[model samples]
Target: MTPVIELTEIERTFDADPPVRALKNVRLRVEKGEYLSIVGPSGSGKSTLLTTLGLLDRPDKGSYRLDGIETTELDDARRTALRGNRIGFVFQAFHLLAHRSAVDNVGLAELYQKGERRSRTQRAEAALQRVGLGHRTLFRPDRLSGGERQRVAIARALLGEPSLLLCDEPTGNLDKANTNAVLDLFDELRAQGVTLVVITHDEEVSMRADRRVRIDDGVLSDGSTSFQGSVLR
Candidate 1:
């Protein structure tokens, strides 16, 4: 089967007196329907890697192929278009518009797409219902619980039916109960054949994924160990 994401010898560096290497010779492959977690501490290259994978940043040198298209050589507009069409993002903060209803928030994701307004609304409603938030479609973010807000964000991400769902610290702000609720939703999404790549520091979240990789000091490794020892810390 073709991989949904492929990174070959990826390298990204920030210019400084000595230059900071955010990622070094990173190679990763994520197949369709795979649920993978990237675990690391703060300041590790995990965030940089995530940004690169999400097409928010470009590597200095490497090949990044998303769903078989060579993304590295694509221009900014093309990259943005591909990212919007093929990738979905869920963040820790549940970045919903304060004044918009849950259904409106999800519908907003399709604002740039060429579609009838009624069709977009129906799609948003369906996405919300898929995440078990059908009853809360009219609720605003401030009126919902933390878990519900996150579900709204997830529904918004799913509005485009993205091929890959990229979540960054998705459960970071939630309590155990809410975190479990979100994790259960992820399980359901995976069962429905959505590929998920989660970047997080939480061990429980990592453990829930089908595969776990670690990043430290710009180096990526399989499992949890590194030359300096445990990568979790």
Candidate 2:
């Protein structure tokens, strides 16, 4: 089967005064249903890599194949379509609208998606339940805790049953208890066959994944170790 994500000799550089090389000679492959983490500190190009992987920005040079489709030269509109349809994103900040209920927040993701055949509310509600937030569907962001809001975010990401989840510091704002809750949910997702790629600076989060890689100063290297598949919930 084709890999969910494939990057070969990926090179990304920003044209600053000194021309910062955000990613250098990167190569990675993430299989379907696999949970992988990329760990790095600030100024380590993690954010740049995440942006490239999510198609938010194209690489300066390289081949990126998503589910076997070459993406290097795809136009912005096509990239946006592919991103909305196939990629799920969860970030450190809960980007929920303050006035919208959890269900609405998730439903909004599908508002712009063309040819969707399901009821938006029904699909959004099911996604909330998947993240164990069914009871909070009617609540607004202000009424939810940090973890709950993040769950809402995750639910929004799951709107189209995205094949790959790109999470950047997903639990960075949550307390330890809430972090574990979110991680458990991720484990469940992995078991259910959603590919996850998390970019984090936290080692504990990195260790929970089946495989881990470290990115430092634009270079990528293996950083895996034997550990619990889900960590302690």
Candidate 3:
């Protein structure tokens, strides 16, 4: 079967005084509905890889295939549309609107959609309910706990029912209890068939994935363990 995401000979660079190569000929492929973690220390290019996959940043050289469609040459408008329809992203920061209610924060993401789909409130509410935040829909970010705010972020990411969910340090702000809760929710999402690519340095978090890939000094170690048919056991 064709992979849902494929990165071939990826190279990304930043123009420092001496050019900084963030990624160097990185190759990766994520299968459909697979939960995988990219583990790396600081400056290891994990975030760069994630952003490139999400199309938020373009690689200097490489071929990125999303759902079998190559996406290197698409214009900004087309890229944004593809991201909205096919990829969901959660960042380290909650990135929620401070003044908007939890439901409204999520509803706002639907505004960019092209067609008349579900009502904003309905879509937001359903997403919140899925993330175990149904009771906190009316609460604003300031009114919610740290974990609750992160759940709201997750809800917003889920609103699009994306083929690939990209999370960067998703549990960075939460306590241990909340981290476990969020990880459990991720397991549930995997069971229900959501392709997850999480960039994290946390050992506990990385262990939860079906496969663990370690990136050290911008190179993948031999630790790319794949669970071919294991249903996340």
Question: Which candidate leads the pack in lDDT?
Answer: 1
Model 3, 1: alpha-carbon shift in Å?
Answer: 3.2
- Name the runs in model 2 displaced over 4 angstroms: 115-118, 224-233
lDDT of 1 by residue, 1-233 (tens): 77998888889999998999999888888999999898999998988999999999999998999999999999999999999999999999998999999999999998755457768889999999999999999999999999999999999888888889999999999999999999999999999999999999998899898888888888878754552222221
TM-score of each: 0.94, 0.93, 0.91
Extract clashing residue pairs from model 2: none
Quote the lDDT for 96 in model 3: 94
Cα lDDT of model 2 by residue, 134-223, tens digit: 999999999999989999999999888888999999999999999998999989998999899999999999988988888888888774
Model 1 stretches with alpha carbons more than 4 Å out: 224-233
In model 2, the worst 10-residue window by lDDT is: 224-233
Which RMSD values do the candidates have, in order?
Answer: 3.2, 4.8, 3.9
What does candidate 2 score in Cα RMSD to the true structure?
4.8
lDDT of 3 by residue, 78-137 (tens): 899999888888888999999989999988778765434557789899999999999999
- Sort all candidates by lDDT, best to worst: 1, 2, 3
lDDT scores in order: 0.89, 0.88, 0.85
- Which pairs of residues have clashing backbones in candidate 1? none
Give candidate 2's TM-score.
0.93
